[model samples]
Target: MDIAATVIAIEFRLPGPININTAPAERLQELPGIGPALAARIVAFREEHGPFDTIEDLTHVPGIGPRTLDAVRDLITVVDER
Candidate 1:
């Protein structure tokens, strides 16, 4: 008798860039290095201050620094819903 082995792989893609202006904490948490605390901060910051004018503005969030911003910059977008 002989046996064969098979390998499989799966890939996931976001429908599009996450809109930082509109994404909820749950959605924002999906970004790399953005955990619950940071995700909440992002939401709160936006609510307190207003939508981000630029992706770089995310750094203004308490926990989001240059490194964290860099990690998710390509995956995020800033749109003015207003």
Candidate 2:
């Protein structure tokens, strides 16, 4: 007689938060829930408007809102050289 079994495991990790002000789109996408389009929008919005004064300011971007902001707040930051 013979038997077969399978096992699986899932894991989640927290990478150090990224700085929104200076991080490239690729790096920005690493934030939870952010994708290529959203990351590009963030960068474009920053370039066209200006560096975000606070995390809440991300609301100005087309896709981000209070909910989305809250979701990734801990995984994002800003450092204004201005």
| lDDT for each residue of candidate 1 in 1-82, tens digit (9 for 90 to 100) | 2232222221233256899999999999889999999999999999999999999999998978899989998889997433
- Estimate, for each residue in 40-82, the C-alpha lDDT of model 2 and write its tens digit: 9999999999899988899999999888899999878786433
Tell me the lDDT of model 2 at 49: 93
Model 1: ten consecutive residues of lowest lDDT: 2-11
- C-alpha positional error of residue 28 in candidate 2 after TM-score superposition, expressed in Å: 0.8
Instruction: Give the winner by lDDT.
Output: 1
Pairs that collide in candidate 2 are: none
Worst 10 residues of 2 by lDDT: 2-11
Model 2 stretches with alpha carbons more than 4 Å out: 1-15, 80-82
Best by TM-score: 1
**What C-alpha RMSD separates each model from the true structure?**
7.0, 8.5
What's the TM-score of every candidate structure? 0.79, 0.75
Badly placed stretches (over 4 Å) of model 1 are: 1-12, 80-82
